[model samples]
Target: MTALLTLAVLATLLGGTLFAVALDRAYLPLLALFTRQRVETEAPDRLNRDLAPAWYLALAAIGIAVVPFAPDLALIDSPVGIVIWGSCEALIVLTVFLHGWSPNAPFPLIGAYRYAAIGLPVMLPSMFVLIAAALPAESLSLVAIVDSQREVWNVIRQPLGLPLFMVVALAMTLRGPMDYADAADIATGTSAEDSGAGRAVWQIARLAMLVSVSAIAATVFLGGPLGPVLPGPVWLWLKTGALMALTVWIGNRVARTTPSRMLTILWVVLLPLSFLHLLISGLIAL
Candidate 1:
């Protein structure tokens, strides 16, 4: 199961990386793998800076491991799998913050603080959304969540769930509109100091997190691997890939707002909507 999960992760990551690279950028990750150099930082937290991407990648792996490629099949099928995934989402904010803060540069610190601010609020909606998603299933298990959708998808049951969760996804992966951590304006933001092999690893870790979030999104809202004729894993792959593309596309097109404005929108608007969504989903589940 672990090997199978690893393959799935690799395949999804490859697909997402290709899709992202094909749109509006050259392939630099491979080249970075060969090059090795970085500008010196003044009194940087070497340990955290060096380990941040690895931690991010590990979180992605753990999150994706809970997603069932087929019914009852996953690297980790904990009864509270959704909760475990949620924990990963929460930890991602810290990991990304560490990525920025440990660099000990102005831009990186700013990017780290910005992401932390956005990421903290995003978690409120995510909690409500995830709970709403689990309501119909009446189980925190990802497999049971998939099973609940055998009759009808949670996308229909909880209309606001996926869109709201997308905020969490974008924040978690630092992609598209929510990409403050590596925004170009700040010289790649949190990664402003990154170069060569290190940058490559960071890029891969970001993509891996993207793939991980897309898989969880597919499972929670899109019926996971449920389908006819095709194998369960195939169904999962198709859904996950489609979602990864959608996330990247949305990220590319959505106009980014200033951090303060985004925070207002999230708290003043999206957060309340998630509460309503939870109420509605609970009623439906009842």
Candidate 2:
């Protein structure tokens, strides 16, 4: 199990790197047209500046590494697996904040603040969805959650839970419409100062974060590793990929919202809806 988990993590990291590279290459022609050509530039003077993005990348990798494994195969399979998942989600935010603040640039700093403002409100709905998933399982262990859904997947049982969770997952990964953190309007916002290998690492980390959240959402609501005719890991990856693709499609198709409007919708609409979903789940459990 340990070896398999290690292999999975390494594979995900490599895939994430490739995904980032592909995205960059896809946009290279447009980038070359608009991007300013640089001559000679001095290396960063501060050692901390040189190392900070790496630190951010390391945290992102650590957070993502634990996500693909089933609870039985997990390194830490506590009853509070949901809580741990939340902690891992938080690390993605920290990574963005660190990446933005490390360079001490104005736009990046503002972008980091925007990340916090948007990211924090989504947590409420996310926790409610987690609670909805836990209600049927009667255990916080993700393994137990999957087991509880042996008869009926939570998506059918608590339909609202999956959508709410997916929204929060999208927010956590800064994908889709929730991409205020590094939006193009702010000169790539939090990542404005990033270049070369550091930029590559940051991009890889973002993709890995998306993959990680998709895996968790699959586990919680889509019946992770449980499908017809396919192996557990294969089902898991397929679901994760589908969810990731959905997120990307939505991000590309939908217009980005202002921070204030996002907050209003989350608090006024989504928050109450999540609570209602939790209420329904509890009644159904009884």
- Give the winner by TM-score: 1
Tell how far residue 259 is off in model 1, in angstroms: 0.8
TM-score, every prediction: 0.93, 0.86
> In model 2, what are the clashing residue pairs, if there are any?
176-251
Q: Where in model 2 is the C-alpha error above 4 Å?
A: 16-71
lDDT of 2 by residue, 109-156 (tens): 888888888887888898889888999899887878888888999999
Q: After superposition, how far is residue 102 of candidate 1 from its true place, in Å?
A: 1.0
What RMSD, rounded to one decimal, does every model reach? 1.9, 3.7
Report how far off residue 2 is in candidate 1 (Å).
Answer: 5.3
Candidate 1's TM-score reads: 0.93
Off by over 4 Å in 1: 1-33
